[model samples]
Target chain A: MDEMSAESRYADWIAVHAGQSDLRAWALAADGSVRAELTLPSDSAMPEAPAFEAKLLDTIAPWLGQGSTSVLACGLTGLADLPEAITPVPAKPAERLPIRVSANDPRLDLLALPGLSQANPPDLLLGEETEVAGFLAGNPGFDGVLCLVGPRTVWVQISAEEIVSFQTAMTGEFFDLLAGHSTISAAVASTGMDAEAFVDAVSDTLSRPERLSQRLAALRGQHVLQQLDPSVARSRLFGALIGAELAAMRPYWLGQQVALAGPSDMVDLYARALDTQGVSAPRHASDGLALAGLARAWFAMQEHAK
Target chain B: MDEMSAESRYADWIAVHAGQSDLRAWALAADGSVRAELTLPSDSAMPEAPAFEAKLLDTIAPWLGQGSTSVLACGLTGLADLPEAITPVPAKPAERLPIRVSANDPRLDLLALPGLSQANPPDLLLGEETEVAGFLAGNPGFDGVLCLVGPRTVWVQISAEEIVSFQTAMTGEFFDLLAGHSTISAAVASTGMDAEAFVDAVSDTLSRPERLSQRLAALRGQHVLQQLDPSVARSRLFGALIGAELAAMRPYWLGQQVALAGPSDMVDLYARALDTQGVSAPRHASDGLALAGLARAWFAMQEHAK
Candidate 1:
């Protein structure tokens, strides 16, 4: 079976399971078109899953149960434990989605899927990457592509023939390190955001990004001498650092419409801040893109008789 | 003239000056009785004569022109140098107002009033006991009483028959020493008030006022690597000390109406805090109540003859 027939089969399975419940689905086409859409109640209690899985369910669940909704999950083994009703599809090695391995943690290799390449898998993604690569190479018929971007920011770029590509930002990890452990952490006094101060600080950094490194010293001086009011300064520092990351990533996401998947409050604040710089408010999705991505890969393999 | 006749005559003079454009009269009373009164312009500039003559001219100039006022100056060695129209009334040794003397200053003895008893004055009055007693004895005909409350909180109690007393408070001085100069001052981070944290610390001290002295330990601990938030603890210590003073003074000021005369903002805050303990708001008077009390004493003697 070719990739087209395999994608149709996976779409059929999604439509059947979605109709049985209140699930939604969206068929991601080859040319970046989203079709076969359906909507579910906004306040629906979604199935609990890992962070990535939950994201995918939220996004695709809205479009599920409408008809035969096609979704291409590039890696199957990663979604093997997902709800048994969702079939896994697979695709060729060339069509397989790319997973960048930046950190070399050992435990991750235990979870790697076939056809997933790791330039430096550290010690973790080694096993899982091979399995993921094999699953994708065995079947050339997955519908959509799922791209896992870094450990925190994940993007699921969908297409009917295959998932084209996706990207992730290390935003959450960066925030944790900066606030939790570094000397810079001491400069901030409060965890909650102050909107006006934050906006002002971000605007300052955006205009003079080169001064980013010097911000830590200024914050420390103000706090030590009791010259700066702490509440205002803390909010400003958080905004400035986050602004620096956003500035760096501007080129990749310039024209792309993306969904946000994270803690609600943080996402809301980030969205508001992003909107100030002309970024659209992100669409929130519930389904774990990785699970759907994996299921799509499995079904493709079955269709190929691999 | 007897005390009653003396007071009545002064009152009449004040009434006469009250109608004059350049004359104003103020009297200080003690224990519901008039002790001294003086007359001057409702808006008089500083007098130009020698200290004693200037004080006298300030009193009569409002009623008589320079020519008529000098005519009253005959036979007075202190008055001979004055314009003939101005009369120099001999101030009674009994009517001399007491001058405040610093407890530690040796220069105080040179100007000590003669013929006054060197005995204990009231504790509510500020200054050395000898100075207050001496002034009261030498200035018997003076109805104005100079009462220095503490180093900063000064009150002049005057009456028409004799000058009474004045008092001052050292509260501001104490605050300056603790928060600006001493070792405890070094511990505090120079910062604006953190209202909630400060109030909490103050309330804590209120419960254990006896421990007020040791509360500075928290600030010192932070300074010496005790791993506490130094800025917060320092503010708390300051608040606690202020609270302690308030607690101490509450007993002395029961039921009587007291006026606060100082910097507007500090007075306002202190009044608000005092109100929390059922004390009424203090009326704010202008500064230099001490000088005004002394002037009132001088004028009271002049009125005794009429």
Candidate 2:
């Protein structure tokens, strides 16, 4: 199917499900024009396997009733329980296998669509590059990637070609830990970070990274001696450590773009850091990325079948 | 004087001080017998200098106002702010200073006792042979000694002696760091510990105490692999390490007694641990230990002057 027909078909399926009491829909508009729309069940509580399957059928039957709506997609394994009328899209190898709703009947169309799968993958896939590569190698029918970064950063890189992955320590998380709980943490308390002081400390340490351990020790000593507040020292230590990590990781993504993900405030801070280093900002979106990526992956799979 | 005369004298003093709006009276009773009393101008907050003299004055002032109430007969800090009126009651070198107060400082009288120099003493006097020796050595007194036994197990020891001292560590705190925020912390989420698990771990490792490092490594591995709950492992690690410290310190106390002081709940727990190990429970009280010790010291100074 051409792009226009494919778009029209997806729209009709959404429209048929729009009035269903059990479904919730969200539409995104660009320049006053509806760009895309997605729906989920309003009362989609899955009970037992059979009940879950019934709900899945109830959710999708209307969409399937629109004969033109040929493809039904879900990122959860629960959707795999749908009647054969709903074609369950196979997850790309890079994507996570939907959690089995029941062990006895594994053939149920309960599998989640590519959108949800790509949006949030399994915890095991987080921060593991080798596993990401393995996932991609196994599932070549995925397109697009969604990366979650912050306290526990996760990358869900996807393409119809498969998933590629790498995981890194949450330097931000480390910074928080040191600030809040460590003996070194006490030094920074009561003293808010002086941005200039932090930048100076970071710059100094980045130039001579081996001093990080010694600096931490000294800061801890000063705190115990009551010479410094723990919080201030904590902020400085965090800034220095994260700065070092960033400096180290800079070479890895030299040319490749990285999309900013996670809480907006954190993303803003990261964006500022990236801007300072003269790196280009990567494209970013919340839910849209997963939806568009899933659509693209589904379209590619259809073309391959044709 | 008989009890009636003593009561009459106290009443007169109280009447006199009652007219002084700024003065506050605090009565001391031992085993339901009126032992001593003190009255002070609440406006004259505890001063920071001439530490011993100020404490002595605060201790005996009320008794002196009652017309030479015999300190030798009572053997207590006779009233507040008149230590010179009391005769010193010499004590055995190892005997803790004698003073008594209620469990919590619920009464304003108990709190109004001039600052009992207590808390951390100067480092030089730590591990001194006796409280008397500590006093003679010019060791600053302590108000209280808070002994943390494990992550959640704490024992507060108050010094009924002229000088007080205590120790601290990062065992429980470090466990929190490792289990809550560290890379390895994630491994132990959702694990539970049997009450005996830690005790068993400690006992087993006692023969080869150096095995602690190895056990820690194993626990860390299990946790990081998500085979154990981080909290359980963290608590276990804390209990094991603290248990080891207790085991080491138990021998040093030998036949000597120890008073567990702090919040009643903490003292009870420590007492239970000691009981399980067949250690004898000594007298435990909270507020007046330091004050009593200071009072005894003041009496000693008065006798020396005489």
DockQ of each model against the real complex?
Answer: 0.01, 0.06
Model 1 lDDT tens row, A67-154: 4334332222233222222222322333343332221222121121332221111011211222233333443343332222222333
Model 2 regions lying over 4 Å from their true place: A1-110, A113-123, A126-148, A154-165, A168-193, A200-234, A240-306, B1-171, B177-306
Which candidate tops TM-score?
2
Note the Cα lDDT for every prediction shown. 0.38, 0.38
Local accuracy of candidate 2 as per-residue lDDT tens digits, A1-306: 134344433333221121101332222222112334445653212133455455545554423323333322332223342332122223343333322233233222222332221111112221122223333333344344433444534444444554443334345554566567654554666545555555566566556443343344345434433345554665567556545554445433444454565556555544545555565555343333333333343344445559
Where is the poorest 10-residue window by lDDT in model 2 chain A? Answer: A114-123
Interface RMSD of each: 25.8, 13.4
In candidate 2 chain B, what residue range of length 10 has the lowest lDDT sum?
A: B12-21
lDDT per residue as tens, model 2, B140-166: 343343342322222223355323333
Off by over 4 Å in 1: A1-169, A226-234, B1-306
RMSD per prediction, one decimal? 25.6, 14.7
Top DockQ hit? 2
